[model samples]
Target chain A: MIKQERAVRTREALIRAAAESFDQDGFTVASLTRISSRAGVSSGALHFHFASKAALADAVEEAAVVVLRALTHDAGRPGSSRLQHLVDATHRLAEALRDDVVLRAGFELSGEAARVPRTDLRVSWRDRVERQARRCEENGELREDVTVGRVVSAVVAATVGFEVLGVRNRAWLAPGTIAEFWRLLLPTLASDAVVARIRPEGTLRSAG
Target chain B: MIKQERAVRTREALIRAAAESFDQDGFTVASLTRISSRAGVSSGALHFHFASKAALADAVEEAAVVVLRALTHDAGRPGSSRLQHLVDATHRLAEALRDDVVLRAGFELSGEAARVPRTDLRVSWRDRVERQARRCEENGELREDVTVGRVVSAVVAATVGFEVLGVRNRAWLAPGTIAEFWRLLLPTLASDAVVARIRPEGTLRSAG
Candidate 1:
């Protein structure tokens, strides 16, 4: 039992280290030896946990999906309007992206052509956002003129934009930046009654 | 004069080759030998034209700036409303990005962290957009409630997002995609009187 627990901890540490390396150097150049060193593990130990750099990246991507899936599930809690759920989810994602290297690396690695990711994060995110938008349409929360495809494209593009821009400027990840986007977009997207009920700041209190 | 003309053509070919390499392989991994070969030039000739890879990247960035500067200048024609010019420029940029490898590479190399870019394309683009938004404010073209800063951030973010997304999917660069974004945004942004006059097609005929 003790050995199993220790192995699990080492694996987690190595995953975190690999995510940092991949995020900084990109998938093509990130070295497994360096990742192990960053994690304070021997090369043999890294090999034991992950057979190759691609496997390590897959693990990192899986971990990121876990974090993202939780955020999506939490945001989609029953009783909230679908549009509000999407608003909250985007804010949460931006906050996670600002604070978490794993998520950032997941996004970066998925975009890289040198490696085939186990799952494409952008497609996953677009599908999730599209699902919620469809739900909003079914609930009649969307404005009569707004199409699900249009909202999906705008929201996906803006969120992906924030991720790319945040690479250079951390300010792009700020809650206010996302809030401002929602504030501008919501009036045009949601029905009049729904617009009044939704808060651009999301249900969560702003740390800023 | 014959030798000088040949030298200029060689230099142009080298720039095109380097842009292709940088756009496909990224700045860190792209090599001078490969670029020279792609340009059908000798290593000695490449060195004579460019001191180093960094110098080559700088030249590509400068050429992109020339293309971008023309787009901005054309969009800001004196007779048009500042907002209209801004819209037209973004559409032109999307088309240029779709057709021009040097401009695409300029953006990619600037985003790369492995090397410092002579010019940061994102910053340059944001500044140009901000200036136009301010001009729109001066001309009283923006809706009374819209702030210049908000418009700048959204426009920059969305445009940057399109560039990044276009890396993987050329469809993102289509005129209709950009047109849809403006179609959704312009009504809310322009005063009711101006909204009717502004075409989301961006005053340019779609090649499609």
Candidate 2:
């Protein structure tokens, strides 16, 4: 293998192992030695890759953000209206959570992220939420009565709520359920007059 | 102090210490040794009162549940209608989250409760949501098209979502936000034809 390829492999292995250990055991129990041993590397290797446990955690969080952003990024492509964009984003997020442990690590770090401000991971999620709200405003997806701030707050709150539910009740967390949650919530947050167009092709019963 | 007074003090000490540790760290890290040391008691003394960490956590959870139950239990008392009862219950839950770390701990421990599934803390919250739904049905507070199951699920989901938000964003989780979240959600979840009756006398305004 090339020298750079070898370095990338070692870093990825360390991150994956650390993410798994951190997720299974809450941050307090996620010792570096356990993570290093799990990765089949010496403690020195882990240190060379990540100077501290917090740095390893930050890398895991950054990886998770990259995954989440990728899931939402495609939805904003041209020709998709704001409502379609949101539906697409929600659907993608649900699938991503189901298929990717790295993505789930974002939810795991969410609690810790709350304590530290201005991290790139935190900023990225906030930015995604804000962009969606701004798009809603520009497209008239939300009611005039609902300001961009209110819509953004409500959507952020709902997304966080959905993540918690997804964590606790993984069995019931399907894309359809998340889509239904957005369908119901979006209309309520939007003005009653403009709610019709964004109401989706069929009701939730049909969606189910 | 008298025996009863001494016992009360000890119990309070344990709960306070445990809450502090759990809040600073999390479930698995707040060892009995640390909790006892913080409380100025021997490990044997700690075990004398609570047999194990799980048992102790159970106690803390139960205390939190008691405070939560009190909010909804009295809703059925003489003069309160179902709608009024729900409004009160919603407000009380927000208050509980703000004033009571025990309640906060219960919420934080939700994922843990899911893993163990012994305490069934979720059942009471479910019951409260069901009660509100039943009341909505009786008072015709629901929209003609809404289902009790969906309304109940949304309410429960929002409660959890807002609580998670409270823990994760202490600064942004302002007073009355939880109540407002329920207020915004209930109407969307409820049938609109009679949704006004469920709205508290003067609480529904454009801002909400």
Candidate 3:
């Protein structure tokens, strides 16, 4: 148990270090050497934990997925209303995407993984998102008109798109653009009643 | 005049070669040496044209920007209706993004470049789109209710969102999805007469 705990700690440290390096220097320039050095581990130790830079990136991405899943799960915990839960989760995810470098870097990593089929991160991430969509459907949060698969795909695509665009165009959309995108988009997918109440004037407007 | 002509040709060749290399192997895996070789030039010649990989990437992205601008310009040429021109330009851009590896790769390069401060590709792209939106508004193709800036932003965002998503999740979305997205989206922004005839089964349906 102690050894396992230590291993988990080391893994977390590696992910955090890698996220910082990737955000600062980009995917190509962020070397494994820098990640390991920041994590205070030997190069061999990194290799033992992750076979290569691609492997390390996969681990980091999976860890971020786990974090995001945990957040959605927490939002849906027993006491919250379904609509409130979704709204809250949307806010949380958007905020986390903005504030957490790991979540942001995971997006860039996923893009790279998509281009390189050898990286397993894309497949695993896809499966996890699919499972989450199923869970959302089960909870009756999703609209009957929506397919779980389509919803999952749209959610992933929109989230990634908004985050990436925000990061890339930070000057024009310097503050609160990600937040605004979710604010606009979430209601469109939500039940009409929820959609009505989420306006700038705080009054329920007619449906779009 | 002779030296200037040769210099222009070398510059164009270098940009084209670099774009092809980056598209085939991604930015990280593509080598400048290989690009120079593929351009049928020496390392010294490539250096004289572009001092570094980043410099080469910038040229490639600029070329793509020029292509998109030209596309928009052609759509807005004399004798074309403004709204029709905007819609047509969007269709052309979508098709080019789907078919041209160089354009798509340029998108990726611009995305990475934008993350770092001082890269203004995002702003320039948005400005170009906004100009088209203004033309549409003047032509009475769009609703007076929607602001040109807002419409342009949404249109640009959705286009980028759809393409990036399509590329990442290429399997779920069929080859025709890009056309489908625009078909669905264009009418949403168009006047009621255009909106009325845009159903899936209508003769005005988008071509794949």
Candidate 1 stretches greater than 4 Å from native: A74-79, B74-79
Candidates' DockQ values?
Answer: 0.58, 0.42, 0.30
lDDT of 1 at A15: 94
lDDT by residue (A35-57, candidate 3, tens digit) is: 99999988887887888776777
lDDT of 3 by residue, B1-208 (tens): 9999998999988998998887666676689999999989999999988888878887887888777777667334665556555555556665667677666667766566223423344455567778877877776777555567555655566556555655555443343443444443454466678555444222224455
lDDT of 1 by residue, A1-208 (tens): 9999999999999999999998888877789889999999999999999999989999999999888887777444566788988998999999999899999888877677556678778778888899888998988899888899888878888898888889878999899899888877888898778899998888878533
> Which pairs, if any, clash in model 3?
A196-A204
True contacts kept of 2: 0.38
Candidate 3 Cα outliers beyond 4 Å, as residue runs: A1-4, A42-48, A71-90, A113-157, A170-208, B1-10, B74-84, B113-121, B138-141, B166-175, B182-191, B197-208
CAPRI level of candidate 2? acceptable
> Which residue window of length 10 is worst by lDDT in model 3 chain A?
A199-208
CA lDDT of each candidate?
Answer: 0.86, 0.66, 0.61
The model with the greatest DockQ is 1
Ranking by TM-score: 1, 2, 3
**Per-candidate TM-score against the hidden true structure:** 0.95, 0.85, 0.75
**CAPRI tier of model 1:** medium
Q: Please, what are the lDDT tens digits per residue for candidate 1 over residues B1-208?
A: 9999999999999999999999888877899999999999999999999999999999999988888888887435565778878888889999999999999898887677566678888788888999889998988899888888888877888888888888888888888888878877787788878878777778778533
Evaluated against the true structure, the overall lDDT of model 3 is: 0.61
Top-scoring candidate (TM-score): 1
The candidates' interface RMSDs, in order, read: 1.5, 3.5, 4.2
